[model samples]
Target: MSFVRTLRQATAADHEMVDAHYGGFALDRQADYRSFLTAHARALPAVERALAEASDLPPWRSRTALLAADLHALDAPIPAPLPFQPGAAAERWGALYVIEGSRLGGQLLARSVPAGLPSAYLAAHHLPGEWRRLLTTLDTHAAGQGQAWQDAALAGARACFALYARAAAIA
Candidate 1:
């Protein structure tokens, strides 16, 4: 099986749990929207920082500023970023998978947000074909790397999901 598919299958439960936490927020309501943005603010910055520091993955624009802009528009304070430091290249790839995958959902979620609310973060969809490029990169990295790399990737993805879950719960 392709590494991306394998990773997805392994982390399905974690992804679903994180979705449940995020799905509970009613984005139409301003307060709920603030909470939603707040929850993301708590996790994304830290993850992006860790990725920037640890990996030489393909260049992708950071969504941290976009998230901050959304929070600023809501007059909601950007919460302290949750600490996240992926320990290896495989682990960083795993975290990146979670982060990039969220953007697909974010596109749909952005539509439900009230018309006047800021959604730069949610609306920050990948440039054309970006997702495919990322998947290719992931698969290339995992090719012949064997089970140890896969395990680290799974651990990284699970840890990332937990971070988002924790941030959501706190928000």
Candidate 2:
């Protein structure tokens, strides 16, 4: 399939996976609602960079704004450390919604200087190979065949699922 088409496919899949991650924890724990987002304090930049680097947008100003709005939906307090119980479906889905929206906006307005991804994705966090694989796919799509975003987004979205699954070690 065309890479652009692949990116959109990845976006749909991205939405679904985010939903699933929230769903999994939502069933038993209320704490999980916020736990997912706690990391976003750092990850949001990653997301923004993913979009910004791709679209050449400025770094996220008020990165916490998106996260805070999502947190408001939950009844539970912000999560603490490990041993957190993922929250109810309502909670998990809310966070996922935030991610989708942020990603969507980033994808929409994004205009990167270069066709390829910035160094952070592979370096800083050094996402697992699975994640890197998708980034690489985006890289290929970005650098390849006229340079595209739609294709990169979908591919990146699909890759995000694998990362989430890997983190959870879900079969």
| Model 2 misplacement above 4 A | 1-6, 27-30, 49-55, 58-62, 65-153, 160-171
The TM-scores, one per candidate, come to 0.97, 0.36
Pick the lDDT winner: 1
TM-score (C-alpha, index-matched) for candidate 2 = 0.36
- Candidate 1 per-residue lDDT, tens place, 1-171, comes to 899999999999999999999989999999999999999999999999988886467766789999999999999998999889888787888999999999999999999987899999999999999999999988988896888988998899999999999999998
> Where does candidate 1 stray beyond 4 Å?
none
Residue pairs of candidate 1 with colliding backbone atoms: none
Cα lDDT tens digits, model 2, 59-130, are 223344555454555433333222212222222222222344444433332232123322121122212353
Residue 170 lDDT, candidate 2, scale 0-100: 28
Give the number of the best model, judged by TM-score. 1
Model 2 is weakest, by summed lDDT over 10 consecutive residues, at: 118-127
Which stretch of 10 consecutive residues in model 1 shows the poorest summed lDDT? 53-62
Cα displacement (Å) at residue 8, model 1:
0.6
